[model samples]
Target: MTMPQMPDSPGTARPFSAELWTAIDPVYAAILDHPFITGLVDGTLPHDAFRHFVVQDSHYLRDYARALAVCAARAPGEDDVRAFAGDAAGAIAAEQEMHAEFMDRLGGSAAQAAAQPVGPTTRAYTSYLLATVYGGSFLDGLAAVLPCYWIYARVGEALLAKSSPDPLYRRWIETYGDEAFQGVVRRVVALADRTGAAATPEQRAAAVEHFVTTSRYEWMFWDAAWRRETWPV
Candidate 1:
C-alpha cells in the first residue's frame, strides 16, 4: 500500500523527521508491499527465506556497527559522537544476544552464521553505508544511518498494530516498535535536523541524496532476502 500523504501543517506535527520521511515516502511505501515484509508479518514467510534474512542481517549488523563507529568518529560534536557511539555498542550487542537467540531457534549456529557468504545485496548495502561514512561528510553519514532506525520503527508500528499471530514475527515487531527504540529514532531525527541546519546547501543536498540511496537499498535488502539471493558463482 502507498504511504498516506502528509498533512500540510508543521504547527501540529512532530518536528525533524517529518520533512526527511516526506521526501522519501514513496520509497518507504513500496517497502510495505515487499513480499519479505508482508509474508513475515503475516506468518506465511518461508522459513528458509527468514533464515537467509537472519544470517544476512547478522552480518549486516556487524558492519553496521562499524559504520556507526565511523560516523561517531566523524561527529562534529562530543554529544553526537557519544550518541552514535552508544548506538554502535547497541548494534554490536544485538548480534551477540538478540540475533543469537533468534538464529538459534531458526537452527543457525554462530559458526554457521559466520561461515555463510554474505549475499550480493547485503554486501552492496553495507558497502554503501561504509563508503558514505568514510567518504562523505558527517551529515551524509547521519542521513545514511537514519533509515536503519527510522524504517524499522515505522514498519514495526505498522506490523505490530496488525497483531501478528506469529510469535517470532511479533517479537521482531516489538523489538523495533517499543518505546525505547522510538526514543532513539527521535533523538537521531533531532540530530539529523541539527546537522542539516548547520550544513551548507551543497552538504544538505548531498546528505539527502545519500538518504534516498540508502532508502532504496533498504527495499532491495528485503527483496534480496525474499529471493534468498546469492552470487551466481
Candidate 2:
C-alpha cells in the first residue's frame, strides 16, 4: 500500500505515524468489527468475558514489560531507550493498579490471580513478541509491539466516543482513550516512523510482516476474551 503524505511539521516534509496507520487500516477495520469491542461499547458484553480479559491482561503485561526492556536496550538512541523503559514501567504499574481495581469489582483475589494459568491466546501473543524481540531487528520488534500501544489508543478513543453506559466498560474505554495515553502512542509512532524511513526495502518488509502478525494477534486477543478461552489441560 502506498502511504499517503501527512501534513508536514514547521520545517520538515516527512510523513509521520499517519502513513503507517493508513497502511494498517484494513486490519484495524477488522479489529473494530470484532464482537468483543462492539459488545463492550454497547454494554451487552457478558461480565464474565470482561473479567476474563482483565485477568489475562494482567498476566500478559508482566511479560510485555520484559519485551519492552529488550527493545529499550536495542534502541538506537538514549531517548528511545528511556521512552521504552518508561513504557515498560508504566505497563507494570497499570497491570497492578487497574487490574487490582477490576478484581475488587469483578470478584477475584490476588491468590486466584497469581495462580491463574496463561490462556492459550495470551501465551501465543506474548511468546510471539518475546521471540521477535529476541531474534529480530530493533525495528522489527518495535513494529511488532506497536499495535499494543497504537491499537489500544485508537480503540479506546473510538469506544469512548460511543460513551458506554456500563461503568466497567466505560472505565476501560476511558483509560485507553485518555489524551495522555495517545501522547505516548504518538511518541512511539514517531520513533517507529523515523526508523522505518531509514530501513532497507527487505528490512522494511520484515518489519511490516511483524507488524501485521501482531496486529492480527490483537484481534485474536479480544475474540479470545469474548470466548473465555482457556488452555487444554
Candidate 3:
C-alpha cells in the first residue's frame, strides 16, 4: 500500500546538543515511573490492568504505524533517511503483529480491542506525533517519537531483571526483553542522534516541545489510569 504523505515543508535543518538530552531527562524518568508501565516490570500489575494496557497499546500502535508511514514519506532521499524509514517500517510491523498476538494470548480480541478509543493521554501524544511527522522536519519527527524507544528500553531492562517464577510477567518481559526488541530501540536512538546532529535551532526547539508535551501527557495518562477516571468522550 502507498504510505500517506506529509505536508510540504521548506528544506531547512538543525544541529543536536547535550541540552536536548538534558531537557528530555525528566520526561524519560516520568515514563519510567508510570505505575502501569512499572507494574509490567515488577510483576505487580493486575492481569486486568495489563489487559487494559494492551488494549490501549494496540490502539496506539495503529496510529503509530500511520505516523511512521508519514515519517517515511517525508524522509529525504538520502541513504540515512531511507535507512531510518526502512527500519521504522520494520519496527512498526513487528510491534503491530507481535503485540497483537501477545494481547490475544492474554484474552484480548482484535475486534473488541480495535473498537476501543484511545485514552486522552494517548490521543494527545499521538496527535502531536502525527502533526510533527506531517508538518515538522524529519529530525523533529524523530525527536517527537524517540521517547517511546527510550522508555520501552528502560521498561524492558527492568522487567528482564525481575523476570522469574511469575509466568504472566515472564511472558510480558520475554516479549520486550529479547535482543530483537532491544535492537529496535537502539536503532531508533541512533537515528535520533544522527537526525539531531543536523537539527536547526528551530528544529531543536520544536523537538524539545514535542518531547516535553508527550512526556507530560504520558505522566497524566498513568495518573488518569490509576485514578480510574472515565476518559472524556
Candidate 4:
C-alpha cells in the first residue's frame, strides 16, 4: 500500500510531523552534505569505517527494537500498537539478516560483530531513545524514533539517484532505498501526525525538541562511523 505524504505549507497550519521535519530541515540538509553520506554515494568510504557502522548499527537496532516495543505498549489504539509491535519484530528479525549480510561482505561474522563494542555515539543515541520511550509520552517516543526512519529513507532516496559503483556500497544504499522501507517510514510519519494532532501544546513542544535532538543524532551516528568513534578512557 502507498503511504500518504504529510502536508506542509508556510501559509497553512501543518501537521505535527511536517512541523517536526521543517524544524530539522537544516539538520537534514547538512546530513545530505556530510562526508559520510557522500562517501556512500561515490564509494569512497573506507572499508573499516563501513564495517564499524555495521557493527555499531547491529547494536543500535536491538535497542531501537526495544524502544519500539515500548511505543507499542504506550500506543492509544490497536492499529498503532500492532504497527509498532510488528516493526519491533521486523527490526530484530528481518533487518538483522541485512546487517549480517553486510557484516559478511565486510569480512566479519554476526558473532564477531556481536562481540564488538558499541561505539560511543551508538551508545549515546540508543540511550536517548530508550530514555525517551520509557520516560515520556507516546508522542515523545514517536518523535524520538522518527529520524531513524525518515532520515534514512530520505538519504537512501537521495543516494539512489547516483548510486555507488561498488557492489557492497550499492547494496547498502539499496536496502534503505527500497520502496518497502520507505512505506514503513511513511507509516511511522503518519502515526506521528495523528498522535501529534491530539497532543497538548507542551507535548507538541516536547516532540519538536525530541525530533531535533534525534535528528542531530542521526548525523552524529554517520559521523561517528566516519571517524570510527571510540571510548577515550
Candidate 5:
C-alpha cells in the first residue's frame, strides 16, 4: 500500500512522494523478502546462521552507536530531536548488550568478532551513514538512517505474523514488533518530512544521495548474507 500523504504545514517538509516511496519501497521489500532474514524471524534459520548474524549485527550496532553520538552532537535546540538521538543511542546500547549475551550463549567473543574487518556491505553502509551524520545536516543524516527504521518495521511486522509456537521466535518477534520500535520509525519519518520541507536545494540533493546510497547498500547487505563465501570480508 502507498503511504498516505502527510498533512502539509509551513514547518512540514514535502511528504514522502510516490516516486521516492516507490524508490525506497523496493529496497525495504527486498530486505523483508530475503529468505535468510525471513528464516531468522521465523526461527527457521539454522542456529549457526542465526548465530553468525548475531555476530555481524553486533558489529553493525557498534557503528550505529557511534552514528547516534554524532547525531546527538549535531542536533539543534529542538528537544524532540535531542530525545530522538537519545532514543537511538539507547537502542544501540540495548542491541549491543543483547547481542553480546547471544554471542556468549553461542560460544563466541564479541571483541574478536568486532575487531575482524567488517564485510564489504557492512563497511559500506555503516561508513556512509556515519559520514553523512557527521558531514551533512541533521535532516540529511536522518534521511540516510531512516531506511533502516523503515525496513526494520517492515521486517518486524512480517516476523510477527509468521511467529510460531517456538519461544525463541516469539521472543525475537516481540522485541522488534513492539510499539516502542514502531514509534521510533514513525518519529524518524516525521522528522524526515519536517527536514525535507525546510531543505534547500543543496540539502535535498544531499538527502537524495543518502537515500539512494542507503537503498543500494541494503541490497548489497542481503546479497552478501545470501552468499557469504563470495562476500568480501
Candidate 6:
C-alpha cells in the first residue's frame, strides 16, 4: 500500500512515527471494526475467547520482552537503552501479573495456561516479531514492536469512551487505557521518531514494511482469538 503523506511546511516534515500511523490507519480502522474488538466493546465476547487471548498473549509478551531487551542492547543512546530495558521489564511483569489474574478468573493458573499448546497464529506472530528484532536494526525492531504498544493504547482509549458493561471486559480496557500505559506508549513513539529521523531512505522504507507487517499481525491476533484458532494438522 502507498503511504499517505502528511502536509508539511518547507524544511519541516512530520515525524516518522506519524507516517507509520498514517500507513496503518486503514488497518487500524479495520481492527476497530473487527468482530473481536466490537465484541470487547459490547461485552459480547465469549469468556473462552478472552481466555485464549490472555493465554496466547502471555506467551507473546515473554518473547516480546526478549526482543525489547535486544533493542536495549542495540540502542545508541543511553536513555533509549534504559527506556527499552524498562519496557522489557514492564512486558515481563504484564505477562505475569495481568495474564495471571485473567487466567485465574478463567478457572486456570498461569502454569496450566502456559502448558497449553501455542495456537498457530500466536506462534506465527511471535516468530515474525522475534525474527525481525533479532536480525534487524534498532529502527526495525521498534517498528516491529510498536503496533503492540500503539494499537492497544488506541483501542483502549476508544473503548473507554463507551466502556464495556462486563466488569472483566472493563478491567481489560482500563488496563490499557490507564494513564501509565498511555505514557509508556508515548515514550516509545517518541523514541521511534528520534531513531527514525536519522535512518537512511532504505532503512526508513524497511521500517515502514516491518510496521505494516506487524500491524497486520496485530489484527490477525485478535481474529485468531475470536476464532479460537488451532493447528489444523
- Predicted candidate 4, C-alpha RMSD: 2.1
Candidate 1 lDDT over residue span 95-146, tens digit each: 7887788888888786788799998999999999999899888888889998
Give, for candidate 4, the lowest lDDT window spanning 10 residues: 1-10
Evaluated at residue 158, the lDDT of candidate 2 is 78
Residue 187 alpha-carbon offset, candidate 1, angstroms = 0.3
In model 2, what is the error at residue 149, expressed in angstroms? 0.2
- In model 2, the Cα lDDT at residue 157 comes to 80
Model 3: worst 10 consecutive residues (lDDT sum) = 1-10
TM-score, cand. 1 vs. native = 0.92
The whole-model C-alpha lDDT of candidate 1 against the native structure comes to 0.84
Of the candidates numbered 1 and 5, which has the greater lDDT value? 1
TM-score result, candidate 2: 0.92
Stretches of candidate 3 above 4 Å error?
1-18, 77-96, 221-229
Kindly list the per-residue Cα lDDT of model 5 for residues 1-233, writing each as its tens digit: 22343456788445753324556766777777777777665567665655556666666777877876677777665766576668667767766677766667767777765765667768778999998888888877777776666666656666776775556546666677777888776777666666677777777767877876787776677556556523433
- Residue-wise lDDT of candidate 3 within 1-233, one digit each (tens)? 11112333478332243445567677767767777666766567777766666666676776777777777776665655575566567656755676677677878666677787677777777788788878877777777776666556656676686774557667767766777777766666666657666766677678877766665665665665555435656
Show model 5 residue runs off by greater than 4 Å: 1-14, 17-20, 164-166, 229-233
- The digit string of per-residue lDDT tens for model 4 on 1-233 reads 33334566679767887788889989999999988889888888898989988888899999999999999999989998999999999889844698888888889799898898988999999999999999998899999988999998988888877999789999988888889999999888888888888889898999999999999999999899999999999
Q: Which candidate is the best by lDDT?
A: 6
In TM-score terms, which candidate is top?
Answer: 6
Candidate 6: C-alpha RMSD to true structure equals: 3.3
- Our tally of clashes for model 2 stands at 0
lDDT for 157 in candidate 3 is 72
